[model samples]
Target chain A: MRMTDRPSNEEGALAPWFAAGREAAPLPSGEFMARMEALALESQPAPRAAPAAPARQSRGPGRLLARLRAMGGWPALAGLTAACAMGLWIGAAAPEAAVDWVATATQEQGLSGLDPASGFDYAMLGL
Target chain B: MPYDAMTDTSDEQLLAAYAAGAPGAARALTARLGPLAFGHAFRMLRDRAEAEDVAQEALLRLWRAAPGWREGEAKVSTWLYKVVSNLCIDRMRRRRGGFAALEDVAEPADPAPSAAARLQERSRAEALEGALAALPDRQKQAVVLRHLEGLTNPEIAAIMDIGVRAVESLTARGRKALEGLLAPRRADLGYEDD
Candidate 1:
């Protein structure tokens, strides 16, 4: 209370008794405190279980294997086999120019066959 | 939390920590709030056993509410006081139409050395308690919360779920009643010298 907000005479008269009441405010018995403590602990919600460690994700070599498995194991292998057979067929029966280009790709890796000067050469021959 | 730090922690934080299973949080909260609930219940009911039961019940509700407690919505102390005030009201209603005898009031929770030394103060406290017991429950509660408990009128209004003016009125009327009740004993209680 501030000096300006002084208590009325009745309030002042009653103040000491209130102070006594405050001083005499009951103390919870040890047994009561223990029971409350037990209740508090018992009622406590378990600390939200730490978010379950993110499910271990398969990585490294297992990643590709997992993807292949996801794509349906034997069907994915069959697709690769079919693609390889197509490449073998191209190798066995393709034109000589295609074979030469393939040779160029594997050997010098040069692409002069794709150069614009070759277009001019074709124009000169009118073919 | 260290023992010292828990004293500084707000009730909501302590409750949140308790809900989250922080060690020592339970005891710390109990230490902070137990006496308050018990004291208010004791003063209102003036029966040690019933007051204890009411205090336990009030704190039990608090424990149950811990998990869902939201800060900034309501104060923990105010909530507990409100619960206690209501619980006391319910208890008093169960025994309505009968007034308590002066001897039925319980003794001081802890008899302080100073209080025991000053017999006059103890008599005055007893006299006031007896006078308070005679007031209507609402008036008694208002007066107790306002004067004995030293709470603000608005806080008492919230606890009692009444308007501030109503609190002021009840307290004023209650004190007047108490003065009337205690007037005869004033000379005997040593007010003449003051």
Candidate 2:
């Protein structure tokens, strides 16, 4: 249909008709507004308190330990310490076993062994 | 600032105030958005209770999102219109029966005049609404947002998530369909008198 056939103003040919509709169908009742306000208030977040002053700033190992504690507390720190100790022991005691395991796994997958200097043999893999 | 000062605040600022737990911000936001949402939903669904539910849910979502409401991202009214439109469309999809006929739909009482002219005006509005209800969902939405809600084509496009060209096409087709539907009642609607 041609746009020119309709009223050329803001609401087309039915602007006055719609205006009457709007007047007849006004906004929701006061009860609806009350319910909405209640719902909105119910969902509104609680106000945040202002930040408190810090006691002291940590430095060096103290800061590192604080960071670890903040991450997951004593258990996490202990776990990290245990992991580092295990790594040291494995490197010192069973380096050959680790290398053999890597080489065997890669060979089984039809891949080359690791280069000690640069990790994987990307050249052999045609990279 | 005091909570009463929020009456003149922008929607974004009012939302921020609401997130900050200001005293009157919730009421302010509700008062501002409730009518617009309800009116749009009512126009779409033509059921007062269902439209009320849709409006409440839409505002509830806005309240939930207020904490993370980023300023300057979009106009708050635009966002609410998008939400209301989606909810209305979903309700329309789940509708099992045909559109409500004019007599079946509840009419809000006209308090203006007790004369025949008032009756005719009421019928004209109802007829337009019925014609609107008979339209396909997208076309109905496009026409409602364009004509009744007085939104620009670009704003309708953003709300409907379609291109401006698509909005234009939907509204054009919707207007044509509406004209055809209302043609039979043109005299009753007093178009002949015009």
lDDT of 2 at B74: 91
CAPRI grade, predicted model 2: acceptable
Interface RMSD of each: 2.3, 4.2
> For residues B97-131, what per-residue lDDT tens digits would candidate 1 score against the true structure?
87665555455444456664466676677778887
lDDT of 2 by residue, B1-194 (tens): 65545566888888888999877888888888999999999999888899999999899899888988888999999999999999999999899366555445445355356677777777777878888888889999998887778788888899999998899899889888877777777776687897
In model 1, which residue pairs have backbone atoms overlapping below 3 Å?
none
RMSD for all candidates, in order, please: 7.1, 18.2
- Against the native complex, each candidate's DockQ, computed on alpha carbons, is 0.39, 0.27
Query: Which portions of model 1 miss their true places by more than 4 Å?
Result: A1-10, A58-95, A100-127, B100-116
TM-score of 2: 0.69
Q: How much is B34 displaced in model 2, in angstroms?
A: 0.7
Top candidate on TM-score is 1
- Which model scores highest in DockQ? 1
Q: What C-alpha lDDT, on a 0 to 100 scale, does residue B9 get in candidate 2?
A: 80
